[model samples]
Target: MTQPSGDPAATGVPTCYRHPDRETWIRCQRCDRPICPDCMRDAAVGFHCPQCVQEANRSSRQNRAVYGGERSADPRLTSYVLIAINALVWLGVLATGWKNSDLIARLALVPKGTCESLSSDGYYPTALGERLCTLGTQGDGHWVPGVADGAVWQLITSQFLHVEVWHIAGNMLALWMLGPQLENVLGRTRFLALYLLSGLAGSVAVLWLSGAGQLTLGASGAIYGLFGAYAVIAHKVRADLRSIATLVAVNLFITFAVPNISWQGHLGGIAGGALVAAVLAYAPRARRTQVQALGLGGFLLVLVALVALRVAALS
Candidate 1:
């Protein structure tokens, strides 16, 4: 009796072990192992071995779980929301029909003495008043009374304000790309804390470096804070460092190349965020909870000290 031509035992045809009746012509792209139609899976326009396919599926599922299985948790979404908010605020200013709008100055943080007159009468001036005071004039190196009178609050608020749409858009884009992943790893609370502290550090740097002249606004400081956090976290998790370095270099280039960019704020935020992250990452793992509490407490104390010093300076 003559054997079949395509039979494995006859002409060396590779038979599908599972489906003995079939001959396999394709190989798994990943494992490079032979597989029949039933065993092969389509993976990005190519076939995959059963074991490789299973492993890839498992990885994908794990990633999905980490991302909360929702598309909105995408880092880009956070960035978009921030940009939208800033744009809306700008539009609101335009809609209010105010001429010579001082919207940015009013909401932005300034140095001491730059707006001292506005701080008179025991009441910090209105946002509009602050804007009016800083108009047609620049500030100097130290925190000005009226300019950054309530700078403690400005630390957080300043992250949302911007002098230009492009400025806000750029910062938001960076934030959107970097924030979610950091948030995912650090969890929302820690991430938020890092952002706030980083912004504060940036504001403080501005106060120390510029003194009172230039009016600073925008989220770059806080976004840079995220960059700082990213570096620390990447190291802790053994993630690729090259990517983080690339991001830092690109942003630094932008800061230097672009006119009117706040290099102080960027540096301050990066430093602060990295400091905090280092404390968080390097502290003994067994005492992580205690260490985190202590770190947070220290931050709060520093914040309070800054506020008290500003008030004392005014008096």
Candidate 2:
């Protein structure tokens, strides 16, 4: 009998279906329901009611990009910032620490902790006058003394520190080349985690496998992590991974071929990076955050256990 109020039969002006108290001629472009200004939301082409917006989103297939992030986001921003920090660190090294052994000793990763015997030797100090290098020791030994000597923080700090001009340049160049693509695919936050965690895992490998008193520092471990990330992500999407694989192979060859490079660090980093990429690329979308947290936490615990076990064995 009533052609519905919205048909303009009952009243001259259409009434809002949601807010019956408010009268308006506006109708949702999708559902054709009368909506008030309070219920209006901007849509791409025209206004939509809240219900229509939600329903549209629900019905949407949520077409995911191969890399797992929203297609709309830009991953380059974080990569650029990360590259800048690394470059700044290198600049600081050049300004005050290019030849400063003390600064290098203070920051570089040293496996040995402070002890009466000085444990082992064959390590060279980046700084000559530092107490860590000059301190009296038993047998053939070199000691690097610092307030933070043998501290756990060295694992993190050591990644950003480099010994020579070509060293930082080489590492930073690789970072610049590989960083943006992976960052875009993984998103900024996950990419940062992969880089740091991969580097840490590399350091942990050094701690586990390197001889005592070896001083190892570089961003190579982290860069290697990125390499692993790209490879793993590609594999997940069923995309070609051979290009990254070849790069990894060449780098690994160089790692072992070079005298000072740490193959232990490289191998550790690759393994860590691959595992982390698995966590990021393969996680279920519904529980991605929770799954990532659990995976990372588990790996961290493994590192702590390895460190404690190694320390206890030596002590």
Worst 10 residues of 2 by lDDT: 114-123
CA deviation > 4 Å runs, candidate 1: 1-84, 97-99, 113-152, 310-315
lDDT by residue for model 2 (56-80), tens: 8887746333445443266666666
Give the per-residue lDDT digits (tens) of candidate 1, residues 1-315. 975775574777776655777788787777677789889877887888778867876776454322122223444454456567767766755665322244544566666534433223311223233455556233321124433355455556667775455676677777777877766655555666777788888887776676454567777788898898889878877889998999899989988898878898999899888877776666675676578768867976785577566556643
Candidate 2 has a TM-score of 0.75
- Runs with alpha carbons beyond 4 Å of true place in candidate 2: 1-51, 54-74, 113-123, 126-150
Per-model TM-score on C-alpha atoms: 0.62, 0.75
Q: In TM-score terms, which candidate is top?
A: 2
Superposed on all Cα atoms, model 2 deviates from the true structure by an RMSD in Å of 6.1
Clash number for model 2? 5
Itemize residue pairs with steric clashes in candidate 2: 101-126, 101-127, 132-143, 132-144, 132-145
